[model samples]
Target: MNMSRRKFCGVGLLAVISPLGFPAFANPSARVRVGVLKFGTVNWELDTIKHHRFDAANGVDVEVVYFAGEDASNVAMLAGDLHVIVSDWLWVSRQRSEGEDLTLAPYSTAVGAIMVRQDAPIHDIPDLVGKKIGVAGGPLDKSWLLIQGLAQRDHKIDLAKEGEIVFGAPPLLSEKALSGELDAVLNFWHFCARLEANGFRRLIGAHEAAEALGASGPVSALGYVFREKWANENPDVAMGFIKASAAAKKLLADSDTEWQRLAPIVRADGRELEVLRDRYREGIPNRPLADEERDAAKLYAILADLGGERLVGKASQMAPGTFWAALKT
Candidate 1:
């Protein structure tokens, strides 16, 4: 699929950068240590960056560290063992409110959805009443909160009170949904894609739910999170990584061959692979940073009302500097 280069932000320099390979004599000081979840989607972009030497082209060396879980990655980042990690802006907002200097660069706008079996009686949020609904990431999950908010606003119904909500890991919820144990399931984007591949139908996507809640456009739920102090000290290296990331997104957005190359690492094949590839491409953040920030602020207000302080911490509105404006393309 051919796409306009304009869709990708901050990658104009790619035309001038040598595409052959990394420079023979590179600066050793421009190295970035990125911590990633072992099976996270972030690895797909990071892999593309490394496979195509996007980091080298942008005058930086990216060192990837794999973790079993996001909490472990967060621990490594807080311990100064890693310079960057992929996480949501909400967490960044909460951390900043607590005096942490962390900030985020927009990564993906992809979010979860409520999925039900194709033959199931569930057709809408109202249909979920008194039905067993499997929710990944627990009660305070942004996706779950958004669904609750949407349900309250549109139908005058409270899903939490009217439905049987079961919280569990994404994979487990997906399995239960497939086995008919769950009337519906809300899982992460990749898991949702897998469910879709397996003939599950989406009752409502989080993006649509956000729009119903007054979001002007697609808002990125996740980003490349890093310390403000570290970015300030290594401005060039930070900007290089951002640029490399943009270039990688551009490549992935335009190349089916690239997705095929990533088959093994993605651990998917056939219809599942195609669905995952399409969903990932759909998640590429294309709007301007200002637009994203504004929508995120609106979402923060909605999520805060539903999730309360437990999810948002001490921050009232999304803490200032939640979205790293300096990294805006």
Candidate 2:
């Protein structure tokens, strides 16, 4: 893949500066450690981070950590071991409330349509009444927002009520739903493609769910999160990461070939790259925070409605002292 001159310069700068020492990550030690999720759709940055033709230029050693969920990343953050966390919106909100020094760095992927078995009775959001739905990543997962968005607008079905929905991991839900153990699976990423290939039906997404709810907005998508303290202590490092990311995004925008290069790294079957790439295209746009706060608020409302408000807390509670604050700089 080709890189612009700016990207090449960024890479060179990272290499030149990495030898200098710092308390958080010392010089002449292991490469600057950065935590990354192990999901197929989420960690696509690794392709650019590791092989951006500028990896050595970034002056930081990238350490990819495969987290089972946001909670795991939180545990790692609390331990002060991981430098960054990347996942869906709800988890980010939840992490913020707990006094974790994390902030959204940049958006990665947009939440997409919910899926069900093709033979399943779930034809639309209204059909989800009394149906068991597969959910991933606990209450803070994007799937929860989709469900609430559906209930609040289309079905008028209250998510707060019991027996309205059943949530579980993709594998378990897929097994149960496919084996007649459940009615529908509300999942994301490779599972959607996998389930669809196995004859699952498309139910709804954050986008479609928003439309159904009489809203016009792109919901908060995936993002790069890191500790405020870490980022503050290493402003150059943080900026370097984002700058390189911007460069990578430019490459992606410039060529499907760039995406083709990144696809195999994140995709398990290499077929879902199209799906993943599409989500990426509609998401962050190589920038940080957007002027709009509605999507983030929508996520909070859904979490509050789902009784996860204690986990998500208020927007005011999410401080401006973190990486999100840095985005402005």
List lDDT for all candidates, in order: 0.87, 0.58
Per-residue CA lDDT of model 2 for 211-235, tens digit only, reads 4544345545666777676666776
Candidate 1 residue lDDT tens string, 128-181: 999999999989989889989999999999999999999999989999988899
Candidate 1 displacement at residue 300 in angstroms: 0.9
The prediction achieving the highest lDDT against the true structure is 1
TM agreement with the true structure for every prediction: 0.94, 0.73
- Backbone collision count in every prediction? 0, 7
lDDT agreement of model 2 with the native? 0.58
User: Model 2 compared with the native: what TM-score?
Assistant: 0.73
Give candidate 2 misplaced runs (Cα > 4 Å): 1-31, 66-70, 88-98, 117-121, 139-142, 159-164, 175-182, 197-201, 210-216, 252-273, 284-288, 292-294, 313-318, 321-323
